[model samples]
Target: MTYTFDIIGVTPIPKFVQFQHQFAKKPDRSKTYLGSYECSLDGLISATKMIPHKPNWDWDQVLEEIINFWVQSEESIQHWKKQLYTVREESLLVARVANSEALRQEFETLWQE
Candidate 1:
């Protein structure tokens, strides 16, 4: 079974569709806000079934794809700072949620640090 989750803020580098094939298959990958300088895409979707997420998903992968997207994109890094991207870091939490309740507690404990 597929679960739905939000890919908080996904915007285009240009005024129109960027179609970052990296996340193309993701369902409802639609543009949201458009300003004088940038465009955005936002959605909650059935991740695996809708989009082709890279496998062997490690915590580093999260930092790479989602976090590093704007950081490495010289042109966009500034935008990330301006927006004040605030997301709950839940990398280990996800795995813990499935492993065991105790593990989940441990995940949160580690995260709080």
Candidate 2:
């Protein structure tokens, strides 16, 4: 199973930063599990405007560092549970904003101003 979260509007650009954590079996015959992760950014831009894609941070490097640390660190069920909660919270926040008609109108108004 994979867990996903999005951090929206945390940067200058109007974009959704998606984070995914993937799980799979290790290549060795140890019958152990391993994790791989990835992140993507989708911009919420106006159709009339064209802007080059850029991010201030090195997202790939940050993701690599985080995954490396997670894989190397000793973890228990509690740690994973905490991570699940974090994912849930971020996911909920994204959902809330995406589903809010009022928020959408507000952004539209701001953009038109």
Candidate with the greatest lDDT versus the true structure: 1
Cand. 2 TM to true fold: 0.23
Superposition error at 61 for model 2 (Å)? 0.8
Worst 10 residues of 1 by lDDT: 90-99
Model 1 scores a C-alpha lDDT of 0.30
> What tens-digit string does per-residue lDDT give for candidate 1 at 3-105?
1121234333341234335333443322221112222221111122232433323323333343334334555544443453342321110100011333356
- CA shift of 98, model 2, Å: 26
Per-prediction TM-score to the true structure, in the order listed: 0.20, 0.23
Clashes of 1: 1
lDDT of 2 by residue, 1-113 (tens): 11222232221111223221111121211111111121211221121022123223333543443344434544532344354355623322121011133335657887898
Candidate 2 lDDT at 62 equals 35
lDDT of each: 0.30, 0.27
Model 1 TM-score relative to the real fold: 0.20
